[model samples]
Target: MTALSELNDDIVRSMSVGAVFSDFGGKVNSLDFHRTADLLVTSSDDDSVRFYDTTSAKLVKTTYHKKHGADRICFTHHPSSVVCSSKHNLDNSGEFLRYLSMYDNRCLRYFKGHKERVVSLSMSPVNDSFMSGSLDHSVRIWDLRVNACQGILHLRGRPTVAYDQQGLVFAVAMEGGAIKLFDSRSYDKGPFDTFLVGGDTAEVCDIKFSNDGRSMLLTTTNNNVYLLDAYNGEKKGGFSMDSSQNATIEATFTPDGQYVCSGSGDGNIHVWNINNEPTKVACLDSYIGVPTCLKWAPRRVMFAAASSVLTFWIPNDAKPGLESGGLNSEV
Candidate 1:
């Protein structure tokens, strides 16, 4: 087990894995945190979306999608509302885009247009609008206030979209190595800037903007992660996901934007310092099964990673004797 003192010299590491939640009974597809509450939400292959109390490690709420299920979910500014793309079964006809009320599990609105499954979804930082990327080769932008799609961008390959912190701009990465930046208000003008990463062979699986909105994280199916300047698309260095056996990994920046963390197919969670010389600081094997979804709290030093099980992470100083809770196990 590597402690904060051993890995970064004298940097005083303030982070560690805290709790393990595995009641979902299936693979967790996504994980998200509430901006103002100590609550977290997860969507899973069990055909359910679950709410958990971060502090108590208790189940707060559960909503079932049954046949079609839910995936790629994001919470809106509203406390009781969330938008999630439907996960359809083999015989289903059309996919549904839903605005669901967590209070009663009621469907508020449905926006339908994608020709295939929606693989990615992201809510705006400052508004009720959201975006979805699909295998159908298109990106759809919608407003919660309206039931219809407000705008759409047609691309050549699979797309993953994310919004900047201010909701002023968004980035779209397709099957090719190209990443396009668009103005939130006028996206139809097409991307004002584009960055080509790797070569034409690198297939990007996910993309996220830092909380500070200055740098972007791009994860590829080829076991690579790239960090790029958000404004100019300059290739600012990156770290490789080579250690992990998982071909598809999701990497994200901590809330403070000082570090980067990613999940491994070997069931280990790796954190790296992005400042100064970028290097791996810690690796935590929290007994998870191929952690696919990872999220950091908006206002705290804590983060949650999900797979077949869900793990809440906090500073090691927060829990002294609990290190034996299996956090010390190497991946």
Candidate 2:
């Protein structure tokens, strides 16, 4: 394995396949690698959430939902149950995630409320509350402790949500290209701040906060990624992927906040350095399907990339010195 000290700012050596986890017949919709454990969870259109043991690359368990299929899946902060989104099985016309299902021994409990399909979901860092963003142009905070919806916040456009590392604050990237920040403690109140980026034409697809909570990253359908000052909502720096015809779906920060990984509809995963002098660190060329999600697993020394399949990459330990030109010195 590559030691943390040996890694330079701009290059990421692709690790060998430590183990292959699953060979799902259908496409993988979304996935999440656990922050503190060796486990990883994946959701697919096949209507299941499969768990894998990263250390052995073995399938530990497979939990199936009775609904049509899952659009997204994530583990709760408490580590006991999983939160998943699904659409109607027969007709895909009405996409509404009225229920947030928790899987335990193949049994499920639905947390229902929203009138539209849930597009994105996240759990609070400070409490057991979880939030879901939907095609209905609204976000609802759910308290798993009581299995009830706590508060609902409306947006001008469809929004994607993520919690900061501390869980005290959360960010929502609206489809109209604005980001709203809110405190988890004040759910019924309005947002504490709003950062406007593009006008009505640009759609914000994803938003993430840095590990230190000092910076925020925003990705738009226009192929632009912006880094903003977390506290002041000032633009720090941004890069455009205008050369490609594909839409950038999601962007995420590496654990150290040195690199940002973006998944695109053109079936490519691009990694970028965020230390002022931005550089494209690595591009994984194997995914033929659109790369929909990316997650960093810091402790396991692995990162999860989801396209049609869920793939895990570790640091290429055998070939340590290989260099990729995309890493910036400041990374």
Candidate 3:
């Protein structure tokens, strides 16, 4: 067999289940892992945010937001702090964005501004500041210490936002395949660089930057995932999904930036070797339902994907070498 095919075979052989969380009663809408901990936070249609200890696969804490159901959940810089966007209160007295202390499920702050449902949320790598994108055609920046938006970018269509690893720059993807990059220090000055993705592809559902801050991934509703040079906006490659499925497939880059993993409506997880020629490396099947959220651990040989269940994939007998940096955590 060719060398590429052999590499694919080896990867498929090494990857296996490291942990499984099957307690989610409804579909998992979003998931985020702590940067340096063995913990995972998940928001589900069950109107709760659950935390799992990756090593033990135990649900450590569950925070239920009943009236304004939880949707996009993410852990801020603090291990005990979480930010999520949910529906308004049944009494029409609250906001869609909330910051909570996960330890006791105490609501610490509420960011109110978006008139429509918030579609996306991302935490900055360096601070308590975070960004939220909404179907209201705006992307707002909020600080955990405040209850109001620090800044807002009004767009023509749905907006998806991401911050670089250093929190030095941020990218915003909006309608008509437009990507605008702004400096975190002075975002109000407008984009310093802009890139336009051309093709039949349209709406961008999610945007993420590689851990190294050198590359970007844009997953669109058109069943296409585009990999771009994060700095210059040059297109590096693109991965195609089965358009027949018509689901919002979330794709993520491994911490090493060598591969990309995504979920399919076919109830399977797909991995691609992007460091070489960007080919389909493997497909893991037999999932109970469509896995909508996929995230790679920041410093481990493992990654996690969620459907109604949370599954962690790790390379068997994998050792951290000179390249992988080191083990992420004790987990």
Candidate 4:
């Protein structure tokens, strides 16, 4: 893959698919990259959680939760552990929200406060605190050290929540293109700022802050991704994705915060450059199923996308002998 050289704007536009891991039998729901551990984790509808080594792009471990059926997954500060939201079968035998230790297959704790399916789950960057947004119309914050929720906020429509890179601030995106910012320290006092990009009435599917915390990405049910100014919620530019399905699309920011990448229902990975006007830089095609779930590597020149199969990507100008270890076939 592209060595860790100075990443310029053209590197992302020159990327190509490097590896394919088609081990999962069902669709992947979400994925997270560890901040400092160089690991990538995924939870899928197939009732499985898989971990991969970012250096080699090899499968490091795979575990299953047949009873709970894992959905959205995020890594806590501890590299060996993760917080997973369950798909939750009708019988209610599964843990809705759980702290799982992937090392020895242990369920450390169960968070049972949400009454409906949780749609968004995010871990704070600087602490054990995590947030979950559910169909029950609430955003609940919890600490890994405690089994109960530490704080809660009730709101209208589906909520998507995320913590800024510093974990000192958080943003909540809701119906009707409204974004509310709250101080992590005094969230109980409610939002200190709110922005209304009113026009699209679709429910928000996802929200993320850039690594530098200067911009935010908002994705909605109608397959639109908007880039916004983090300071005052001004719209920069975004993509009206050419997606054939209604799957939730996620856009991830490169470590340098200069580029954004997302997968489309058409089985292609789209890259966009953020400027006074965002532009689509590249569209790398994949033969695999719809790659709805995606993420950029924390500190590498690569990104991963998944549907029924998982694909790892890198720049086209890598060393000749370089090969991904897991599903070693390069696309």
Best by lDDT: 4
In terms of TM-score, the best-performing candidate is 4
78-140 in candidate 4: lDDT tens per residue? 998999998867236535799999999999999988888889998999888999998888999
In model 1, which runs have C-alpha deviations exceeding 4 angstroms? 1-14, 89-93, 243-247, 320-331
Off by over 4 Å in 3: 1-13, 88-91, 244-246, 317-331
Ranking by lDDT: 4, 3, 1, 2
Roughly what TM-score does model 3 have, to 2 decimal places? 0.90
For candidate 4, the TM-score is 0.94
List model 3 lDDT by residue over 81-166, tens digit each.
89989864723754889898998788898888888888889898888889999988999999999887899999989999999989
Comparing candidate 1 with candidate 2, which one achieves the higher lDDT? 1
lDDT (Cα atoms) of all candidates against the true structure: 0.77, 0.68, 0.80, 0.83
**Alpha carbon deviation, residue 97, candidate 3 (Å):** 0.5
Scored against the true structure, residue 275 in model 4 reaches a CA lDDT of 51
Cα RMSD, each candidate: 4.4, 6.0, 5.2, 2.1
In candidate 1, what residue range of length 10 has the lowest lDDT sum? 3-12
If scored against the real structure, what TM-score would every candidate get? 0.89, 0.84, 0.90, 0.94
Q: Count the backbone clashes (under 3 Å) in each candidate.
A: 1, 4, 0, 0
Report how far residue 230 has shifted in candidate 4, in Å.
Answer: 0.6
